[model samples]
Target chain A: MLTLHNYFRSSTSTRLRAALNLKGLDYDYKAYALLKKETQTPDFLARSPAGLVPVLELDDGTALSQSLAIIEYLEEEYPDPPLLPADARGRARVRALAYMIACEVHPLNNLRVLQYLATQFDQDDQGKAAWFNHWVHQTFRPLEALLADSPETGRYCHGDTPGLADCCLYAQIWNNRRFKVDSSPYPTIERIFAALDELEPFRKAAPPEQPDAT
Target chain B: MLTLHNYFRSSTSTRLRAALNLKGLDYDYKAYALLKKETQTPDFLARSPAGLVPVLELDDGTALSQSLAIIEYLEEEYPDPPLLPADARGRARVRALAYMIACEVHPLNNLRVLQYLATQFDQDDQGKAAWFNHWVHQTFRPLEALLADSPETGRYCHGDTPGLADCCLYAQIWNNRRFKVDSSPYPTIERIFAALDELEPFRKAAPPEQPDAT
Candidate 1:
């Protein structure tokens, strides 16, 4: 059994949950309130030094931090429904797409970064939303171009299968809705998000579907 | 032969270069001046839709984007000296350590992000450096703790051999020097970085050694 320590609204947590559901792996869900700084506790910090969400605790008490790393661990350990592609090039493509969101968009729009903006720069809600949308569009523009132009993109960000990139893409879309970011400009991304939203695994991973959604 | 498209000072580029050097792979280095908006050119954007540097052009003209993804591809295609450990848990540990820098620190302290603070928020050099150091220390504290306490850690981030995490750590240390960040607080990181610096593979990949280095 695995114990997942996470918050509902965290896009990274959403990614891990989607991956877990897709793998058909059952786990114990433990919620932490991000707004109240619950992850800043000594216990949580002991589990994940960074004190971020989606720490997958194994039965042996081995805690895996970082959503992508955990998902990769699951992929390797389980290997039943692969989140990455078979070939090296294909896997590279999927991981690259996943990184675009994971490394670019989500990092900038993370709650901590947003709080930094508010505290350090005196940015208000409007200013923070602007900052969020700026990064979202910056990466989303190129992401849409890559996905739309590639012959490799099928029902998901990779092939016909829902893989690593789709997990990131699906989670990001849910995060995007909070700012009311218009997806009309990215038809390919919009289509893929729609397709992913239809799937039970992804839908169940949505923020609103989580136990701690508030 | 592979063509490495990158900027001399980009930490991501440095990561890729270190990986290539470690793997004993030869590549034709193609420099892009990030400050001059060289990567924003139509030609470069065609190669990498994200308009980012360190695109690995394969023999078949396939351009791979994202430094970590490219490194993973190199590890898979040419497995002579494996960059990742053989076990799944080891790989997860290495990748998590790498992502702590890649996803958390680098994204926030990137050149463009600094420029954003300058242009959009009226931040000067002092402010930018403060911003840079803030994110660096935020992650480095836990990173230092993780490295110091983990029995899995050896000469590098995972085990005695240098691998994925070392590449990220080495590049990040170089990036930190630009801001003149004090590394003394993290003795473990300082020691690992010093060990890596002594190696020819890592020494050759330093920013000052790049062809287009200013």
Candidate 2:
């Protein structure tokens, strides 16, 4: 059996969980408390060298970190209900949409980056929230524009079927709710999130539905 | 020929340039001066919705954003010198290695993020440099550890052939030089980078070797 080492509230973890659920793959859930520094322990470090969550341990004990990479692995290993598009160009479009949120927004607003801002720059809670919201809006504006403008966009980020970009978008919207970011500005994004929320796979992957949710 | 809208010094652009070089693909280099807010221009934003560097424009006028996604598109379209591994596990390992640098390091230390630190938090050059180095080490230490400890690591990030992870690793080392980061702590990384530097594909794709480099 596989074991998923992650925290419930982590956006990356949420993305991976949705991917796993979408694939109909089951795994043991191992929770790590990020605030308590549980991932920094030697054991967790052995599993994930970066000491970050969403480490997908295979049956052979080969631990794979990086949520996007893990999702790609699952996509490859389990092709049914594919997360990525079949065509290369379509795949590129979906992956590009996914990376826009994964790379541009989430990395800047993740817990560690926020903590670093608070500690290193002495940014207060309001300042941190501002920083988070700033990045969110920065990327979300263009993301919304792209989605709204593109004929390729359907009920989800790509087509009527939910895939990789949907996974990223769904996870990010949940992360935004914690910070109380206004989704009213991105109607396309909001509509997609609502559509995804209606699905069982995405609903089950929500932070509140997780075993370790606070 | 593809049109690559990018900056010479951007780490993501460096990685894509190296990949295109590896694949022996020619592109019309359209330089975006990030510091001058050139990428934020309406013209550039039309090419890339996020206004980010390294947008690969296909001949059909389809613009692909995100360096990794573009590289993957190239890998699928031009599989002569494959950028990823043959097997699922191997591909996962390589992608994980690549994402470690791409998602974790580059996003945090990019030009815009540093400008944000300086403007938003009143961080001086010294503070920005410190912030940059701090992120580099945070990911590099674990990256070095993973590369050093893994038996799968060969001359490059994966096997003897330079691929996706190698492109990311090679570009990041170049980015580090500007920040004057100490590479002594990561001997394996430095050694692999040295090996890669000897290759024309990587050397020609370097920041100093770019047509728009100033």
Candidate 3:
């Protein structure tokens, strides 16, 4: 069986869960207590050197780190119920949107990055929270405009079917709400989330629905 | 012909250049002066909302953003040189290594992020330089250790052949030297860089070799 070594609240982990469920793949969920820093331990570090969440361990004893990489691998190996768009151009667009969140927004607010800010810069909890929401709001505005105005957007971020961009959008929205980000400006995003909420796959993949959620 | 909208010194742009050269693909280079903040213009933002460089426009008039996405598209479309390994595990491992540099390292040292610390946080040139080298060191220590101790690392980062990981590794090393980062501590990394520097494709893609280089 495929085992996903993940943390319930991690946006990275959330991405994997949504992808897995959407692709109709059955997997075992193994949660790492991230708040307690279980991810930093030697065992988890051996599986993933960077010591981050969403390490997907395949049945053949292969451990894949990085959520985007793992998702792409799944897409490559399992072609049905495609998570990405068909054409190369569409794939690139979907990937670019995903990177906008993965590379630009999520990294800045990750637990490790936030911890570094707090420890190195002497930022208090309030300052840390402010830092987190600032990036979220900055990215969300452009995303909202794109989803609301673009011809490509349908029930999801890309089209009527749920795809790669939707996977990222859903996970990030969950993170935003958890942080109490004012998502009022992104009605399109809210509408898309509502659309995703109606789907059993996305709902089943929610953090609250995961085994590790307290 | 494919068109690359890029900034000469941008790490992401450098990444695309290396892959394009390695694939022996011809591209029309349209240089945008990043220092002048031309990337924020409405024209540029239409293709990439994040207002970043290294957007690849294909023959079909479809634009691709994000360096990694562009490279992957090239790898998939033109399979002659085969930038990725054949097996799924190997592919996942290579992609993970690529993300270790792209997501974990380069995002922390991008031009916009550095400028943000300078203007927003009152960090001076020295402070910014410290910030850049800090991430390089933090990521390089583990990267060097991974390369040095692992038998999988050969003349390049992954295997004897130049692959996706090498593309990312070379770009980061080239940027590190531009900032006058001391690379003595990472002997294995230095050795790999020396090997990569000898390659014609890697040589032609170096920042100083670019047509728009300052």
Candidate 4:
């Protein structure tokens, strides 16, 4: 059986869960409390050298980290219900959309980065929240524009199928909403996320659905 | 002809260039001076709302952003000399290694992030350099450990092949060495980088090869 090392409310973990659900794969979850510093333990670091979340321990004993890498591995290992589009360009587009969130937005706002802000710069809650929302706005504006103007955006980010882009965008939107950051600025993002949240895979993969949630 | 929107020293662009070179695909490199705030100009932002470097404009008018996504697209479009390993697990390992550098290391130390540190927090040159090296160490320790212990230590990042991981790792290590960052701590990384630098594709993909370099 596959085992997922995850933390509730981690955008990376949330992304992996969505991919797993979309692929209809079953796995045991080992929840880590990020606030409690469970991820910094030697055992967890051994599983993922980067000490990041969403490590998928395969039955064969290989532990894969990085949400995008894990997602790609799943797509390659299980070709059914394709998460990426068929054509190469389409796949690139899907991956790019995903990266806009994964690489650009979420990296600057993760727990470790935020902790660094508080520890190194003595940023208070207000400072941290502003830092968080600054990135969200820069990213969300483009995302909103893309979703609104591009015909490629269907029920999901690309076509009507729930693909990688939707999975990524949904997770980012969820994080934004959780921080009480206003989403009224991006109606396109809100609309797409609303559609995705209505789906069982996405809704079930949310932070509140996790075993570790309060 | 494929047009690559890039800046000379941007690590992401270097990765794409290496991929292009390794695949033996000829393309036009349209230089964007990132340091001069050229990327934020309206013209570029129209093509890339994120206003980032290493946007690949395909012959069919389709634009691709994100270095990994662009490289993956190239891999799919031109599979002559594969940038990934053959087996699924091997592919996952290559991708994970790539993410180790791309996501964990480069994201924290990139130009914009550094700029934000200075402008937003009044960081001096010393402070900025400290922040840069801090992340390099944070990322390098695990990377060094992975390279030292894993059977994947390889001449490149995986075996003798120069695949996706090698491309990203090589570029980041080059930045490390250029900044006179103490890479002696990561002998495994340094050794692999030395081997990679001897290769023609890597040499050709260096920042000096681009037209924008002073």
Instruction: Residues B1-214, candidate 4: write the lDDT tens digits.
Output: 9898998899999988999999988888789887788989999989988888898888887888899999999899899799998888889888988988888788888888888888887788888888888888988898888788898768888899899999998789767766679977888888998898999999999988778887
User: Which candidate wins on DockQ?
Assistant: 1
DockQ-best of 1 and 2: 1
TM-scores, one per candidate: 0.99, 0.99, 0.94, 0.97
Q: When only chain A is evaluated, what TM-score does every model earn?
A: 0.99, 0.99, 0.96, 0.97
Can you write out model 1's per-residue Cα lDDT over A76-131, one digit (the tens) per residue?
A: 99998999989999999999999999999999999999999999999999999999
Native interface contacts kept by each candidate, as a fraction: 0.89, 0.92, 0.51, 0.75
Kindly report which residue pairs in candidate 3 clash with one another.
Answer: none
- Candidate 3 per-residue lDDT, tens place, B90-201, comes to 7777787788889888988887777767765668988788878888887787777767877778888777888898899889988898788999999998998899999999
lDDT value, residue B184 of candidate 3: 92
lDDT of 2 at B77: 96
Model 2: fnat (fraction of native contacts): 0.92
iRMS (Å) per candidate: 0.5, 0.7, 1.7, 1.0
* Candidate with best lDDT: 1
Cα RMSD (Å) between model 1 and the true structure? Answer: 0.7
Model 3's CAPRI class? medium
Which 10-residue window of candidate 2 chain A scores lowest in summed lDDT? A76-85
Q: For model 2, name the residue pairs that clash.
A: none
What are the per-residue Cα lDDT tens digits for candidate 2 across B97-172?
A: 9999999999999988898998899999899999889999999999999999999999888889999999999999
Interface residue Cα RMSD of candidate 3 after superposition: 1.7
